[model samples]
Target: MIRHRDIWRALDTLAERSGLSTSGLARKAGLDATAFNRSKRLTGDGTPRWPSTESLAKVLNATGVSMAEFVALMGEGNAQALGQRIPVIGYAQAGESGYFDDAGMPVGTGWDEVLFPAIGDPNAYALEITGDSMAPAYRDGTVIVVAPNQDIRRHDRVVAKTVEGEVMAKELNRRSARRVELVSINRDHDDRVLAPEELAWMARIVWASQ
Candidate 1:
């Protein structure tokens, strides 16, 4: 049965999964912040007020969440509604070898994984890229999913680790005997060359939903 409560529940679940309140979700969707407020869910005469399709679509797009997943979230119990806990590590710490335990498990706290997308591989990790350093292509606050096992090729966007313990995302230009040539997506940023010894690890950018 299609009930107004179901729709409300779905929105609530989405808010929780995204770590945002109902009003926050609405604002993120470019809607009036009060659009999803509980008081706005009903009319003065007690008629159920449902969100417009446009509003719902906006929320889905903003959250990078698919419709199928949204529906599934709505159907789940409150405990399950909190979303799956995946390893959430900062972009700066991604290159640290021991940040993840020997078993490839994430260690420490300040990690909150929400339901954004299902990275099929258990070893897959995500890093929320900050700043416009790689912009004109990748904007600030873009979340990039890195697949360590994925093959990296020339000209591909990659997240590479340096022996100095720094991690940065740049387009792979070419690899030579002495160094690697990397291009910056944002022309404002200069390209870089790293000596062989400076490179520790590199992974191709599997997906970026920004």
Candidate 2:
């Protein structure tokens, strides 16, 4: 007895779990960009249109979600999928004392909380963007989830803190024993490289609410 609305909502949940929009999810599944769009959910005659089983199966495969998990998202089991909470702080306050540890993991008090799909990292946290400094890519008020223990790789967006207590969100270009090269998220800023000794720590940004 799966309702049409339930199926649609399950798709929305899957998109959110993967940090993507409905169109993005459709593209990832190799379907038409409007496959999961609301306009396509109703016929021209105003009749409710249901998603095909084939499309659902393809989405599940592309997102690495099992059919059981998709069904769970449509039912009371949805709670189990989105209940993980992480400490949150304003990006502007990230450099303040008592907000982070030496390793750049969030610690201490004054942190708010935000619920997200399970990221499986106890050291994960969220940062609320406060200004247009990271515009276009991450606008003001966007919530980005950071994974401190995740491996930082080339071309990944990251939150980095320097030993002098400045926090920056940039894209990693290269990293070596001596220095790390980073490209600014905002095009107005110039690319820079800093000695490894100048940075306190760095963490990968895993997800962002855009």
Candidate 3:
């Protein structure tokens, strides 16, 4: 199956490795900032949004990752090639009350459905941005992939969930004895420091569209 979720996850990984958010990735690729945003993922009636070939090529070029590498990141390897199948849903509906469980796993309910060729791994999922706080780097409606199994390194862009129930995307700076520092990709955004106790979970960004 050509799962779209897998492609999204791969993009998230690439962003993290390059220290960029979805919007940052789009900027690096010379595309519109919202090219990868969640809002653009669907039409008002709900549809599977697709990226232009030119944009995809640009993203691949900016990341310096080959198509094979991207496919591998999505866990399909070269044994299978991407088809037209993709999973579709509204960005606003992705994080609805029942869409995710207490552990943040996809619960597969309350979603406005649409369909595309399956091109990604079933285990992979997408997250929709709900606010403009990450603007210039990520606009409202940008969909981000969280690859929990991917290795996280210093300077990587990450989606961090705090114990207080806050989810934020920022660049991982340094970890000291008791605190973690994160740098925002947007110049207007300030860096943040959090105590270890405030951290509940952190995942590396694998891929983003815009």
- Give the TM-score of each candidate: 0.56, 0.69, 0.51
Q: Give the per-residue lDDT of model 2 (tens digit) for 105-204.
A: 7877657776555667888998988888888888887778899999988999999999898888999999999989999999987777999999999999
Total backbone collisions for each predicted model: 0, 0, 28
Show pairs that collide, candidate 1. Answer: none
lDDT of 3 at 193: 96
Local error of candidate 2 at residue 62 (angstroms): 22
As a TM-score, model 2 comes out at 0.69
Candidate 3 TM-score, C-alpha based:
0.51
1-210 in candidate 3: lDDT tens per residue?
555667677777888888998889999999999888877777789876777645876797678775556666775553244532223334555434554455544566454332212333443455667678887767776655565556679998887766665667899998777999999877687888999777766667665645
Candidate closer to the true structure by lDDT (higher is better), 1 or 2 = 2
Q: lDDT (CA) for every model shown?
A: 0.73, 0.83, 0.66
Residues forming the 10-long window of minimal summed lDDT in candidate 3: 112-121
What local lDDT does model 2 show for residue 111? Answer: 70
lDDT, candidate 2, at 121:
80
lDDT for position 8 in model 1: 89
Error of 3 at 114 (Å): 8.9
For this target, which candidate reaches the highest lDDT against the unseen true structure?
2
Clashes of 3: 28
Identify the runs in model 3 with alpha carbons over 4 angstroms from their true place.
Answer: 1-104, 107-123
